[model samples]
Target: MEIQKNLIQLGQSFKTKEEAITFCGEQLVSGGYVTPDYVPAMLERNSELSVYMGNFIAIPHGTDAAKKEVLKTGITIVQVPRGVNFGDEEAPKIATVLFGIAGVGSEHLDLIQKISIFCADVDNVVKLADATTADEIADLLNSVEV
Candidate 1:
């Protein structure tokens, strides 16, 4: 999925994973991509399983049950230059970029796959994490080879 300029928030710093995820959910809700209920579902999904994808990134999305709450396909990217911890004391997982998604049907799967492949390269993730502008991040993602 190509990054939307308006959906991206650059230079963010969240205290907790929950707070960061909430911000992503709010972005989706405010963008008219999903219903308000979808926010709680995102939290629930994260609780059930961490959205932390490693390499300083996290992709938070609603549970399968919350699929019905989606109004349209959308994504929100939050760049945390300082990074946010997404793990416990036993293991520390600091995420510098958060990708919140609300997709219709199976569309999000393709997006997730693309993101996974793009992010698999630690250098690419660093570029995103260090990006200072939304347009820069968008261009990076849009220009990347799947």
Candidate 2:
């Protein structure tokens, strides 16, 4: 599946994972992609999966809600000033969080997987976190091959 470049940017500039998810949900709602009721559920899911991987990175996501609608499946990237715990017992300075939300039985799993792989690289994660604009982040993502 061809990942939408705009969607990738939507996931990379949130102030925090929570903000990212909320903002993304709002965007989806405004864009007629999802219903407003789905936001709380998504937040709950994010809270449940918050995990901090050392070096300022956290991958937070929801459960089945992610796969509820193809249009709802999107990744949100958040940059925090002080960072959050992410439920990690040690090394929890995660300043950047990536939230992956998928629709039910999403056919875009490949795209999601590709994003996961791209984010696994510490250098890339750092670059994404440091990116100054959506276009910059898009450029960074474009440089990565699926």
lDDT of 2 at 57: 59
Per-candidate TM-scores read 0.95, 0.64
Report lDDT per candidate. 0.89, 0.55
lDDT of 1 by residue, 81-138 (tens): 8889999879999999899998899877876788889899999999998888888888
Task: State the lDDT of candidate 2 residue by residue for 62-89, as single tens digits.
Answer: 4565445335454444444444444435
lDDT, residue 72, candidate 1: 91
Winning model by lDDT: 1
Once fitted onto the true fold, the runs of candidate 1 whose alpha carbons sit more than 4 angstroms away are none
